[model samples]
Target: MTINDIKNLLNATVVSGHQLLDTEVHNACGSDMMSDVLAFVKDQSVLLTGLVNSQVVRTAEMMDMVCIIFVRGKEPSEEIINLAADRGIVLMKTSLRMFPACGILYQAGLRG
Candidate 1:
């Protein structure tokens, strides 16, 4: 599904990479642990996380994740947002918590 679809599905706000809302994502992985994310790579994926820090952006970069969804209304700082933006990564904030957000996307056909 497209990043736009994800944003709509979770009623999220685009914090950065607004121009990339149409980017396609095949799967999603929700995690607060960067270690787990490092252990696996999902192609054309989005990282759904509650960790609103620059490390999240760095992990997404290392994993080649196209988008980072900050769960449970967590919003990253300006530095974190700029880092993602500089890397051409899409960033958004969703009110849904990690589990529910991941479930919604999964049920909508985005494999985890």
Candidate 2:
């Protein structure tokens, strides 16, 4: 699925990277622990996370994720947004919880 597909699937709001909303995505992993996301995620283009910190962006960068979704209405700080913007990562927010967000994207045909 594309980033735009995810946004449509979850009714997410773009926090940054408006131009990148059309980027494609293959897989998704949801976690609050940056360490777990870093240690295990592979070939995942989208990260559905509750952690709203710069480390989240950094971890997604390390894992080569194309987008980071803040679930349950979480928001990233300016520092996190800057980090993501610099890394060419798209940032989005959704009111959906992590599991449902992942499910929505998965049901929409995203796979790792």
Candidate 3:
């Protein structure tokens, strides 16, 4: 699904890269641990996390992820948003917790 679709599915607010909302993401990974994400995730385009740090954006960039969804209503600082924006990554915030956010996307046909 597109990042726009995921935003609609999760009722997320776009924090950055709004112009790229139409970007397609076939898989997702939900985690707050950058180490776990770096060690295990593969071929995922979207990251759902509660962590709101620059490191999160770095991890997503390194993993070639196109989007990051901050769960539990966590909002990233301007630094983090700028970093993702610089990397051309979409950033979104949602009130839903990690599990439900992931589930909603998965149920909508996004895998992993």
Candidate 4:
């Protein structure tokens, strides 16, 4: 699914990268641990996470993740958003928690 599809599926609001809504996403990785993400994620374009920090953006950068979906209604700090914006990474937030958010995307055909 494309990022737009995920947005619609999750009822997410874009925090950044509005111009990148059309970007396609083949897979996603959901985690609160950056170490796990770095250790296991492969070719995943989207990250569904609750950890809101500069390191989240940094981790996405390292993993080449195109977007981050903040679950559980969590919001990324201004610094985090600005960091993602600088890297051309998309950031979004959803009211759904991690598991259900991942499920919604998976049900919509995104895999990892």
Best by lDDT: 3
What would the per-residue lDDT of candidate 1 be over residues 1-77, giving only the tens digit for each residue? Answer: 89999999999999999999988888889989988899866564799989888999999998889899999999799
Q: Which stretches of candidate 4 lie over 4 Å from their true place?
A: none
The parts of candidate 3 lying over 4 Å away from their true place are none
**What does candidate 3's lDDT look like per residue over 29-100, in tens digits?**
999999999999999999999998999999999999999999999979989988899999999999999999
lDDT of 4 by residue, 1-112 (tens): 7899999999999999999999988999999999999999898989999999999999999999999999999989899989999999999999999989998888889998
Model 3 steric clash total? 0
User: How far off is residue 19 in model 1, in Å?
Assistant: 0.5
Ranking by lDDT: 3, 4, 1, 2
Tens digits of per-residue lDDT, candidate 2, 1-112, equal 6798888889999999989987877778889998787778788888898889888888888888889999999978889888889999999999999888888777888874
Candidate 1 to truth, TM: 0.96
lDDT of each: 0.90, 0.87, 0.95, 0.94
CA lDDT, candidate 4, residue 74: 96
Question: Could you report the Cα RMSD, in angstroms, for every candidate shown?
Answer: 0.9, 1.0, 0.5, 0.5
Candidate 4: global Cα-lDDT?
A: 0.94
Better of 3 and 4 by lDDT: 3
